[model samples]
Target: MDGTLIVGVDGSGAALRALDWAADEAVRGGFPLRIVHASGWEWYEGHEPSFGINRDVVRAQA
Candidate 1:
């Protein structure tokens, strides 16, 4: 298939587990894996956003 296998992770164990399963499925089907992670903690909790994340790497690859 030309479609990708997408998984969303939010720094949770459950999400990570889902990612692992999705990865396996993607490999078995010869599809690409896309990890999607989003956070709004900075806006709600006044916390600073995370830096040095892999956003640049993902964007470059995309």
Candidate 2:
């Protein structure tokens, strides 16, 4: 592939599994891995106290 391997992660078990699979594929295919996390709290009506904190933790783990 000519493009990068993009993976979406939400700090969940499923997202982590997908990330690991994507990373493996990226390594085998020689593609750059891009991990993305979207916090939709800003667009939502209610507040999420763990939104920002979770992003920080995810970033550190990444």
Candidate 3:
């Protein structure tokens, strides 16, 4: 109640499901939900890289 709900996104089905759940929870709780996608691997480039942080370390700091 004192903090916020933060979710991570990896473009996976599970991630999408989590997003849906977060949205629902936000609506019910009357709070805001933050969706974060972290894509920092070498394979993820261009738009993919633009989605999230580069690695877990960076996200943890955030």
Candidate 4:
């Protein structure tokens, strides 16, 4: 945890490219690579909660 490389992923093509670059940098720098997937939809007051919506589904989409 001393030297970690954090990469934000959103299940997008651009994110995949960044993840690849971060992985290589992590390896060369001898640091741990941490992948973080996040969503703000759950926190937005304007977001409507439907019957099928859940944290798992949101996380999977991230």
Highest-scoring model, lDDT: 2
| Candidate 1 C-alpha lDDT tens digits along 1-62 | 67999999876889889989999999999999999985545533653345645668645543
Instruction: Give me the displacement of residue 47 in model 3, in angstroms.
Output: 13
Colliding residue pairs in candidate 3: 40-54
For 1-62, candidate 3 gives per-residue lDDT tens digits of 74578889877889889989988988888887888886646544543444464667655743
Error of 1 at 42 (Å): 5.1
Top TM-score model: 2
lDDT of 4 at 24: 96
lDDT of 4: 0.80
lDDT of 2 by residue, 1-62 (tens): 88899999877899999999999999999999999986555544554666545677645755
Q: After superposition, how far is residue 55 of candidate 2 from its true place, in Å?
A: 10
Query: What 10-residue stretch in candidate 2 is worst by lDDT?
Result: 39-48
Off by over 4 Å in 3: 44-62
Clashing pairs in 1: none
lDDT, residue 26, candidate 2: 99
Stretches > 4 Å off in candidate 4: 40-62
Candidate 1 residue spans exceeding 4 A from truth: 42-62
Report lDDT (Cα) of residue 41, candidate 2: 54
Whole-model lDDT per candidate: 0.77, 0.81, 0.75, 0.80
Off by over 4 Å in 2: 40-62
What TM-scores do the predictions have? 0.62, 0.63, 0.61, 0.62
lDDT of 2 at 44: 46
